[model samples]
Target: MAKQERAVRTRRLILEAAGAVFDEFGYESTTIAQILARAGVTKGALYFHFASKEELARGVLDQALTLEGILPQESRLQEWVDVGMVLAHRLPAEPLLSASVRLSADRKARDLFGTSWPAWIDFIAGQLAEAKAQGEVLPHVDPGATATLFVGAWTGVEILATAHDESGALEKRIALLYDTFLPGIAVPGALRNLDTSPDRGARVWKLHQAQHHARQEEAAAATA
Candidate 1:
């Protein structure tokens, strides 16, 4: 059990180190040596988990769909909003998320290792579809199409916000986007109930952290 836990930690360390390096330097410029230096792991250890640099890149990208900071809401549309908001709140501080975007933005890297955008799109579409089924969305709304465009719009906001390089800009932009876009697809009742505030993400993140810590404590007590 100890060995398994150690391996998991080491793998996570390697992935995080790789994400930071890839975020700073594009995938093409990143080297195994750099990743090892950042991770403080031996070459053999990295190779044990990842056969090659490409594998590391893919591993980082795989984390792109992480829904760690999102909490379930009464409305699935609100959950969808939370997804974007939480990502916006966390992306600046998270190398995994930032690195995923950087890698996806690179055409060569995207071709070599497929982007996680499709998975994210599918997840959002599932949310919208469920919302529609629950009568949260308008009858004319197409969940798949809305999801694709929303993803595109979110990507654009990410890029623009990163370019502006202002703190809290991404969150604000995403919140504004939800505010503007949701009204079109969501029914009046659902739209009124949605929380599109820029700070909604921060609040949700804090709640998630508190719950996660509580879970860890409960697990420790159980083992004790």
Candidate 2:
């Protein structure tokens, strides 16, 4: 049992290290040797767990999706919308998820659509269908189409934010996406007027500062 636990930990470490490397250098530029070195694991260890870089990439995706877990079984459309919003906001803050989004645009990754896109699309479609059935969306809204659009928009946003080194921009973008999409889907008379803007840039700035300070404090704590 202890050996199994250690093995699991080692696997997680490798995945996390690979995810960070992939995010920094991209899929094509990254090699298994770099991942192995970063994880402080032997090549043999890496090979034992994954047959190739492609398999490791799939493992990273699995870990990321596992982190998201199953969405709650909700009967309300509004509830599903809220859940989707949470997912959008959380993905940016997660390293493995961000890596997956980055890789989604790679030709090699797209070629592996048989392994990746279906599950992702189905997950989004399920959420959209739930929302539609709960009357959170317009009767005319196509759940599958909306789901595809949502995921596509998410991937695009992640790519743009990464290219600009604007991690803090994710929250505002998510809010904007929701604001833009919600009105069209909202049932008549079910929607209420509300201000969506909240000085997001300033809030993001403050949050970044807070994170920096927290990290500094943690470093100090570790050294002391």
Candidate 3:
């Protein structure tokens, strides 16, 4: 059990180190040696987890559409909002996600490896569709189209924010984006109830962690 846990931790460390390198140098410019240096792990250890740099890049891309820091909400729209807010909060702090975004935007990298954009669009559209079924969306809103637009807009904001590298810029821009789009897409009452706060991500993440710990405790109790 300890060996398995150690292997898992080692793999995660390598991925995170590779992600930081990719975030800084991009996929094409990044090298396995650099990743090894950053990770402080042996080449054999890295190869055990991931065969190559391309595989590591794919791993990063795979994480692009995560729900790691989200909690369920009564409002489907609010659930969707929490997803975005949590992502916004995490993007700056998490190198793997930032690297994924960087790789997705690079034309060369896209030709070599696929991106997470389509999946993200589909996931958001799915959420919006559920919200629509619940009568949370405006009459004329098309869930898929709106999802595509949101994904594009968010990516654009991320690019600009990355260039600026200003603190809280991404979160603030994303919050305003929801504020601008929600009125047109959401039912009036739902829109009024929804939160687009820049700090929403932080709050949701805390709740998510608490819920996860509670679940872990319950599972341990059950086993005991």
Give the per-residue lDDT digits (tens) of candidate 2, residues 1-224: 69999899888888888887887887878999899888999988888888988887888777655313223333344444443445455565667777676666667765763234456667767767876766666888887888778777766765676667665576567667767877886675545632234243343345556777898999999999
Ranking by lDDT: 1, 3, 2
| Worst window of 10 by summed lDDT in candidate 2 | 66-75
Which structure is stronger by TM-score: 2 or 3?
Answer: 3
Estimate candidate 1's RMSD in Å: 1.8
Q: Which candidate is the best by TM-score?
A: 3
Q: Give lDDT per model, in order.
A: 0.93, 0.67, 0.89
User: How much does each candidate deviate from the true structure in C-alpha RMSD?
Assistant: 1.8, 7.5, 1.4
Error of 2 at 187 (Å): 1.0
The regions of model 3 sitting more than 4 angstroms off are none
lDDT of 3 by residue, 120-200 (tens): 899889999999999999989999999999988998998898899999998998899899889889988888888889999
Instruction: Give candidate 1 regions above 4 Å deviation.
Output: none
Give lDDT for model 3: 0.89
Model 2 clash pairs are: none
Ranking by TM-score: 3, 1, 2
